[model samples]
Target: MNPSHSHPLRIGVFDSGFGGLTVLRALLRELPQAEFLYFGDTARLPYGAKSRETIARYAVSAAEFLVRQGAEYLVIACNTASALALDDLRAALDIPVLGVVETGANAAQAHSHSGDVLVIATAATVESHAYATACAERNLRAVEKACPLLVPLVEEGWIDHPVTREVLSIYFTELMHQSKAAALAPDTLLLGCTHYPLLREPIEQAIPAQIRVIDSAEVTAAQVAAAVHAPQAGTPAAPRFFATDSPAKFQRLGSRFLGQPIEHVELIDLEALEAL
Candidate 1:
């Protein structure tokens, strides 16, 4: 589809939880002229640990919900859901569906000349080898690490707190140790989880200065911009926010990710997805 002809594109972004706000924030910044619909499945969050079948079901439901809400394009911001359910979602939805893993992997490959890349995400994302597959397709090496505790830490707003630092030290130590043992100390590390970006400061402090950290949020935003139709020259587009639950909490936490206060957030009933 010619996105440039589709003015005021209605873009949809979904995550297992609030972490997807990271990607939404980036998109809003990159494409302020585009309209957006954000869906956070806080009712069924932490999809990282779920089974593949379960993740697929959730993804399909989320995509259907967004489509019903009039989304012209869809962005699956959850790494776990993207890794396990993207194909299913594409088959089930008519709109163009994009995922963070592929964008992140491509960014990592482009930034890492050494062919050494580290991916830190949830257990499901790591186990799925999504990053490994993306890198292998380009004949590059990638190390996958799962920092399960980091998501909760970020959600709790402990980005630069002492506890966050302590936990990060432990995770990074293991990641670095694994990389060194494999003789693949990556020059770039992919923050595969949206929540990871919230902890970027602490993560940077824990890792070596020589290593570069890549946030998929920007890459995903660029992809969304490329896929959506550009806005008309004189038209103004406003971003919209939606959540399955806790609009107030989403708005409060969203400000941190969005870098500004969200004017309003609307709550939607995800149950309507069953009909879609």
Candidate 2:
């Protein structure tokens, strides 16, 4: 059912870190009529290396927080959470929950003409084999690599730094070598983490041009647009941004992601999660 134009739909987006802002940016671009509530768990950032059980717990808490804020639908913008916690989240939330993994996997499958795909993500996501599972389900072959340091590098805003380039070379050399050794170079490389999108240019330069890189933000945004109930006309809703810590930093970084200033970012007390 379409949402009436008189009222904007409230969509909640959550991430373990600032990376979720990338997904939120795309969502805003695709669905300008909707209002968004973004929560970045900066205190517990980088869920990539955490245990599956731990990631799931954190994800559920974040989802519950968003729901409590009157979110009608939720987006798990963190690939780590999507990989390890999506099913459990879906069962727990009354509203429809969307994740980046499946949407990204679909995009990779569609663009990968060579039948070989490479997935680069955090340790947790790579270990979860979320992309591999999705590819297998679609009758495709997959190779997964974990770049544990990439997130920190991106967070430091070093995507264009010389050290970043050097690190990319080191990280991607193995994948390139493996593809060559397998006699099936991957035609597509999936930037399985949201933060990886910011490193696209460097990553692209480090890899062969024949290999296309896919980021889930765009595809996920399109899916969100399709799934949202249309907003009521003339209804304007403002976005509420929240961070577990460093509200000012979040606002600054969020403005970079959103392509506009985030006038206000509230600091959330995630310690409350323990009580819950």
Candidate 3:
């Protein structure tokens, strides 16, 4: 579908929790004038722990809700949902749906000359090997490592803490060793989690200076903006925020992710939609 710049675009960003706010933050910066509808399925958080079928069902419901709200474009901002339910979402929705895994893989493909890339994400995403498959399709070799502790550390508001850096140091040390043992000279590191963007500063500092770090949220936003055309100047509309549960937490943590105040958030009942 051709995204025309003739009018304001209603873009939907969906995630299982507040982490995906980083993607919306990037989108807001890239297309500040466009309308945004963000939904966090906090009622059923940690989609990584769910089965493939359940994940597909939950994601499709979120996509349907956004489409009904007049979302012309859909951005699956959750790495777990993107890894497991992207195809289901595209089949279920009639609009253009973009996922982070593919975008991150594309970025790696473009940045790598050695055809070897490194990915660090949650345990569930790493187990899915979605990044590996996406990289393979682009003729890139990828080594995926699960930094299971980083998510909690980020959520705990320890972005620049010494403990966070220590954990990251260990993860990077192990990742580099693993990649070398695999006989892959990886020159690019892909942050496969939306929450990882918040830790980009520390991550970049921890990784080798020569390795190019790719943030999935930033890359996805760049791709969406490129596809949707340039931003326009007008009285830009305030983004609409929704969460299946915990509007307060969404607003609180979301403000941190967006790097600005999140004025209000609406609580949604996606349970009814899931049963539909």
Candidate 4:
């Protein structure tokens, strides 16, 4: 059943860091009336290197925190959490949970007539083989590339720099070469990392014209809107932001991802939850 929101619906969005703001940015467009509570587990971030158990524990705590904040639906905006702990999250949370990986694979199936797609994500997300597994479930073949440098570059706010473009070029060149070597004809290039949406322009410039670029944030927002059919507009409510680390730093860098200034960022301690 599709999830429809009532007026003033509370939607919770969680990420290991500020990258998930892109997802929240898209969701705000799709569900303008719904109130948003975004949590950035910045203190325990770089979740890519954590064990599955640890990742699940951190994600579950974040989910529970959102639920406590009256969130009726949860969006796991972090690719690492979504890749490694989606099933655990879904099983543990009562609210419906949506992840970038599944939404991305669904998009690949819809966009690729050749049933082949290429994914560029962080090392941890690619290492999980979650995208590949999700695509195969839809009868689509996926080639996953671990672009570790892209995240830091994005966080550094060097999105349009020549160096960023060159890095994108190098990654895409190798990805294309690898795709051809595997005898796969891919027509879709799916951005598996949330931060990737920020570098979309440069990344697009580096890819072949024939390949369609799928923004996971965009697709996830569309899917949420489709599932939860509510009024197109609701009362204008300022989004509440939470960070486990420095609120000032989060607001400083998060403004870049959200394409606007972020204000009223609240710092909250999540140490107790981490032990859970």
Clashes per prediction?
Answer: 1, 9, 0, 0
lDDT for model 3: 0.91
TM-score of 1: 0.92
lDDT of 1 by residue, 76-192 (tens): 999989999999999999988999998988788788989899889888899999988988887789989988889778778787799999998998899888998989958999999
Model 4, 50-155: lDDT tens digits are 9899999999988888898888888999999999999999998888899999999988998899999999998899999999999999999989999999989987
Per-residue accuracy of model 2 over 123-212 as CA lDDT, tens digit each? 888889999998888777888888988988987889889999999999889887776777766888898998888898999999988888
Off by over 4 Å in 2: 232-236, 273-276
Worst 10 residues of 1 by lDDT: 229-238
Q: What shift in Å separates residue 48 of candidate 3 from its native position after superposition?
A: 1.2
Please estimate how well model 2 matches the true structure, expressed as its whole-model Cα lDDT.
Answer: 0.85
What are the runs in model 3 whose C-alpha is more than 4 Å off? 1-7, 230-233
- TM-score, candidate number 2: 0.92
Model 2 clashes, total count: 9
Q: Give me candidate 4's TM-score against the actual structure.
A: 0.95
User: Pairs clashing in candidate 3?
Assistant: none
**Which candidate comes out best when scored by TM-score?**
3
TM-score of each: 0.92, 0.92, 0.96, 0.95
Which pairs of residues have clashing backbones in candidate 2?
Answer: 3-230, 4-231, 4-232, 5-231, 5-232, 5-233, 6-232, 6-233, 7-232
Model 3 lDDT tens row, 164-265: 999999999999999989999889999999889889999999998889999989889999988875347666778999899989988887888889999999
